[model samples]
Target: MKNTILRFNDAVYRLCIAVAGLSMLTMALIIPWGIFARYVLGSGSSWPEPVAILLMVVFTFFGAAASYRAGAHMAVNMATDRMPPALRQGAAILVQILMAVVCLFMAVKGWKLCANTWNQFLGEMPGLRVGVSYLPIPVGGVLTLLFVLEKLFLGDQSHRRVVRFDLVEESEGAA
Candidate 1:
């Protein structure tokens, strides 16, 4: 059962990373084209800007979930690191609980926002629903919530430090 849950979590983590990466890649391609169209071609494209904004929203939220799962989210570990073992464990638990609360708040509020805007359309892209753009907020929140639970209960292997053999080999060759 634990293994199954861990595998599911891993799958979600990979999905978040892939989606974020693709969104960023799409934005990278779109922005340059937008600039070229506006400056060189002398006609600005309406689609690129809105599309880029949407992609950015997706990238940021999903990337955040992936980062949190990997324990890459910004955190000051100075105080916790110095604490005694028992205290450290307690502190960690407290932090996780706090994080869970925050994630819950985000999920609830984001869903409400998404639902409220369901009937509204984007100003720039009339065909697109405004609620669709707000989707990442709740999705990211839920992902983060699951990751936090996994860390709290199952232990988080994602944050473990790892040495890259390829990087080590390259460095040795450089010397």
Candidate 2:
């Protein structure tokens, strides 16, 4: 059951990444096309503005997921690192649990926020409707929270060792 959950989470994370990348690509193209149409073709696209906003929303969520996976999110590890090994471990656990709680809150809040804007934000866009753009926030929160929980427990071999990823990162990039 646990393995199944992790695999599902991994699949979801990959899908989120793909969707975000597509959003970024689409946004990039739309912006350039709109600019080119205005300057060279002497006309502007009405579709690009709404599309760009949607794509940007998707981009933010996916970017956050990627950052979470990469451990690029900010951390105040100074005090944790200074403690003894046992205390450090405890501190890490405490901090991770706090993060999970915060992520859960984010997921719930984001869903409410998106629900409030539903359909109303669905303006003209090149891709999915504007309201759908907000979908990524809750989706990303779930993915991030799951991934973090997995790391804290299972330690995904494909990603990084949970307790000592900084050393892994340092070594992996070392000359």
On TM-score, the candidate that comes out on top is 1
Inter-residue clash pairs, candidate 2: none
Model 1 RMSD vs true structure: 6.8
Residue-by-residue lDDT tens digits, candidate 1, 1-175: 8866776787788899999999999999999999999999999999999999999999999999999888788999999999999999999999999999999998999999999999999999999999999999999999999999998998776765433456546877999
TM-score of each: 0.89, 0.75
For residue 55, model 1's alpha carbon misses the true position, in angstroms, by 0.9
Give each model's clash number: 0, 0
Clashes of 1: 0
What candidate 1 gets wrong by more than 4 Å, as runs, is: 159-175
Model 2 lDDT per residue over 1-175, tens place: 7655654655666676688789889998899998998899998878788778867987887777766766676778888879999998888788778878877887998898778877564546534544467777787778778767876886533454233345545876994
Worst 10 residues of 2 by lDDT: 156-165
lDDT of 1 at 155: 78
Q: For model 1, which pairs clash?
A: none
lDDT of each: 0.90, 0.73
